[model samples]
Target: MGNFFFVRDYCSISVLPGASLTIGNNVFFNNYSSINCLDNILIGDNSIFGEGVKLYDHNHKYGFNPEFSIDKTDFKTSPIVIGKNCWIGSNTVILKGVNIGDNCVIGAGCVIHKSIPPNTIIKNGQNLIFESLQK
Candidate 1:
């Protein structure tokens, strides 16, 4: 109640002992928003996670090991970094090794696997025309 507040509902947050989930100032996590940080997951200040947004830093490797494969992971984790002033839409899945820059808008229901630069808008499977909005 004093200053920082974490409002969660129907969400399972399992951070390993000594593991960290850093929530910046004025950050809000809505209902059904789950953050599974096995390593280090940093959510920037003033960033909001909408309903049903899932962020996982770990993936399961299913193949036998000789060299390595991205598709096969035995529950390994890297790190998730989200910059400040970012708006994450609902039902968005932010995968491992993703560094989202500041002031970026992520469209709803999009699976982000790579890093997004600052002030960038990502929209998948939609035809959008970028016309001048001002007269």
Candidate 2:
């Protein structure tokens, strides 16, 4: 965690053993936000996570096997990176191996599983749309 990092009401963060979570300066998490990091997660300076934003650096690993059962400790993990000045909107879910660049805006209720470049605006989460950030 960096200087001036703050989490508002009900924000939760979990870092598993041997995992790395690095939060930069002036980062903020709003109400009901959560981060489950099993591998690595980095939040750059001046980033803000909106209400109910959820970030995960790992996903449950599963395969179709007759004798296989759900294993709570089995997971596939990667790093999640949010660059500086980014605003992740309410109810957004950022999955593993996602790298969001600087000055980006992700709209509400979006599920992000891919990398986003700098100066981008993501909107209309139900289907999803993208625009270059103006100015």
C-alpha root-mean-square deviation, each candidate: 7.1, 7.4
Q: Give the TM-score of candidate 1.
A: 0.79
lDDT of 1 by residue, 66-90 (tens): 7655564347788999998888888
| Best-performing candidate as measured by lDDT | 2
Record all residue pairs in model 1 with backbone atoms less than 3 Å apart, i.e. clashing. Answer: 60-73, 61-72, 61-73, 61-74
Question: How accurate locally is residue 86 in candidate 2, as Cα lDDT from 0 to 100?
Answer: 99
Q: Estimate every model's Cα lDDT from 0 to 1.
A: 0.82, 0.94
Q: Which ten residues in a row have the lowest lDDT in candidate 1?
A: 1-10
Candidate 2: where are CA atoms >4 Å away? 67-69, 125-135
Error of 1 at 50 (Å): 0.9
Candidate 1 error regions (>4 Å): 1-3, 65-74, 126-135
